[model samples]
Target chain A: MIKRGYWDIDDILADEEPIMVQVTKTIKGAGFLNPESGELDLNEHTRFTIPLWLAENMATRELAKIELPKIFGESYLNILEADPRIISLKDRSNYFFEVATKLNDFLQDGKFITPLQKVFVARFVHLYNEITHNSDPKIIKKLTELERDIYEKGMKTTREFFDWRERKFDIIRSAQHVVNNAKRFKLK
Target chain B: MENEITLPESEFFAENTKITIIPNFKHAGFQILSGFYGPLRPSVAIEVPLWLGVFLKRQQKCRIIPPAWMDLQVLKDKFEEERKKEEFSELDFYYMEVSSLLLAHAKEDIPNHVLICRLIQDLQDLRTSKIRNSLQKITVENLYANFKDIASIELQAIRRLLPATYDSIDYMRKTENND
Candidate 1:
């Protein structure tokens, strides 16, 4: 019943991130999804990269099987387990958490379920501290799109509360959408 | 998910908290939508919502009586209690909004308002640190967080973060049957 990400731009983009899968059943006229393939039909038992959403659908229909991305492998997770605060996970994928979770849903072995949870919690705590005692704005560079969304929300509330305490609420600010609208329709 | 109350909205709700004020001018009472407010008698103390009290205080028609916890002694003790306790000691749910409104308009009514402000800031900082420190105990297995005495404003602070986390975790844990 949950209708998530129907209009979420980040969710849409996360669905577009590439995933590698091996074809079990050859598909005709699907090779254009990967232009480098150049073939008219996708060949069987050969590996190729495709958008995650296509891979998920193909995977569920027994057309292909997902190969774990290098970043989602045991070693990478171990590095995160050692100290999630140290590494910038955004390097692996901007939508690391979202893509990983969606991929996990396809995993029949459920290998990613526990480690993904552990990684998330660890990163979440680190993100929590940084938000409260934030000295650096560049910290967003390290966060995934998901964490960045959470961070922006937390930072907004923190700033609002501080403004309230200092009685510096400048109520004359225009909403971002209004500003964007005016920019779009500005007179020459 | 869209239910988190913003600062202005929370403040508007906090306006409903009752406080005592002594009227210098005569007024029968108010019959506004929320409820009926005091039948004001000159020099006689009457209880009314903070919004009405602040309104009357602004026009110099009434002297606002600072809430019990607004005193220096009470705040100092509260600051100490917050510093010493891991669990949040009880505070008025609308403490932040109420105090800000009072200090902004009715500063002359409160004795040692300066020190009280300082103490409130300290208390807020202590509780904020407490909330942050509790993050260490959170893990995949034990996300059983008890935010018992956290105020609305403070909850508003974490509302976006913790719920998003819970949602992501739920997404990752999605079972085969759910689809």
Candidate 2:
């Protein structure tokens, strides 16, 4: 899970600090293969990096409404068998980031986030996760710079933010600050 | 060398040699004491105006500290020191930082309702403290009042001073022109 600050609703919950949300590279199950024609029926599974935040009120009763039609509605109908809250945050802040659409109201409202903005969000998410989970400061400046870059670029999306995340995580275990913090939080 | 000095060597040397001694002494022993001057060099390096540093760091991704060796304890201490230095600067540079983050990442408008709501709530708490007229007290009211005022005024102005958006292509163009 990726949290950007203390105000995150999960900060108040049980072991919700470094909430784990696997941002894995998806596999499309099948890909086209052909040597002679050099053409096959395969689409690369899209990679996703989702920063799951906190549950708003922490009850399934209201989640059905808060996360329904507006958030994962159509998708909810299909994934309903899996439980909608699994992907949605039933919180008041209206946070939602599904990699495939990375286009929810959050990212599409603006022109587009620059690569720098993408990296910045990734850095901040990692920082917040760390502060929540580990309480480290070494990455604070990086987080601040990342935040500044995003503001300078207007804003970014979940996909753009995550695209930079996997890369930034690989580039700098800076995000590990959050992972480390998560450990500390769990110990407490 | 002593005999030459006794002979008064060159007139130019006689005059300049004495003057150069100060710098030499400084380079030798005095500079060591400078270390006690509060890690000023690192302070200055990190204290560089936020916008300028961010712009450069983004371009030279690997130029800043390699994340692997980043130390949070050190960073926290430094930030604490810097905050102490700027305690009376009339700007919540830090909170503006928070506002900036909300603006940059939220998938929606610049005002960012969630962050704005948070900001407004914080400000309201500060306003309550203002009404009490006891700013010296360490309370959320005082902290928020000062933080909110700083955010609305100084930070707002600074935000306006920066570009509303940046593009890698434009950055490349600027770099190419410099070369």
Candidate 3:
């Protein structure tokens, strides 16, 4: 029953730069081609950029290691630490929070979070706490408005992206179920 | 004081709703707050309530052919003409909602749907950027006054960005006052 707007996060993330990852083990699989660059072949110890969703899948399966770029490096942390203003951070990097969280999720199993991403997340958490728990009513109202914007726009996109992936997986599972049923019947 | 207070208009009108079904389907009549509507048939044009039209359109059961005033050409001309005039022209109250509804639901039915969507989005972006630019120089007294002409949905979109904008502006104002 939820009404989806055109500005959802899946659409936004689709337009964002793909995350770069290095192949730890050779992945000889069909449909692993970089859709944008049309590079189908992936070899061991080779580095390539893929969409965030795909990169997350590969990293989670131990097929690749995520390489956090320099923009998400210590230098970026220095800049954010100096300002610590929400607007300034938003202007500097629109996808920083999204990218950080995605990377954190992908690397959770291995505890592979980068030093800079760690710092940024900690800093953002502090700011978020202050904005939510502020004493001033006017400030609270304004901050709530801002938070609503972020949640509605950004979170919706994230939800839609994951939903599409889930639906795709559902189709695959159903097909596998049918195949398994067919094999069992053949044995009977 | 009466002149200064602009009355908010209702977002949708049920009486004026009409739609064309692209696919075949049947539905039993349903009761709504306004009245009863339905028994919809495929490939046939029917006049239903606005809520029914919207629901059917979202389900891809029908396409709401836009009103004459909501034509892409008409909107484009109006937008261009408004940009040329120093004074802003009064627009339909439901301009934002109607256009967005059509773009979202009846995309296949609308000729050049992509172009129309792009134009509407560009126009909205221009308006939002202008509002943001003005917000940079706004005072608390003039904040509501500045948004008097914007559509309700457009205003809703801008409200999200206002908190951060207001925060920065308020900070600057306080610092200047102190100085």
Compare the candidates by lDDT and give the number of the best one.
1
Query: In candidate 3, what are the lDDT values of residues B1-179, reduced to their tens digit?
Result: 12211112223442244444443587675677756666666766666655567677777767676666566897798778756744334565556556665665567777888877777667665664555445444434454325556765445443433454445334323333332
Winner by DockQ between candidate 3 and candidate 2: 2
Name the docking class for model 2. Answer: incorrect
Off by over 4 Å in 3: A1-188, B1-29, B38-45, B58-63, B85-88, B140-145, B160-179
**Candidate scoring better on lDDT of 2 and 3:** 3
lDDT of each: 0.83, 0.29, 0.52
Residue-level lDDT tens digits of model 3 in A59-141 = 77999888885555666666655654343444433454445444544454223233333333333333433432332333223
lDDT of 1 at A174: 83
Candidate 1 has a DockQ of: 0.55
For residues A31-81, write the lDDT of model 2, one tens digit per residue: 222123233422223222222232122112222111222233444334422
Question: Residue A177 error for model 2, in Å?
Answer: 21
Candidates 1 and 2: which is better by TM-score? 1
What's the ranking of the predictions by TM-score, best on top? 1, 3, 2
Question: Model 1, residue B146: what's the lDDT?
Answer: 78
**Which residue window of length 10 is worst by lDDT in model 2 chain B?**
B17-26
| DockQ scores for all predicted structures | 0.55, 0.03, 0.01
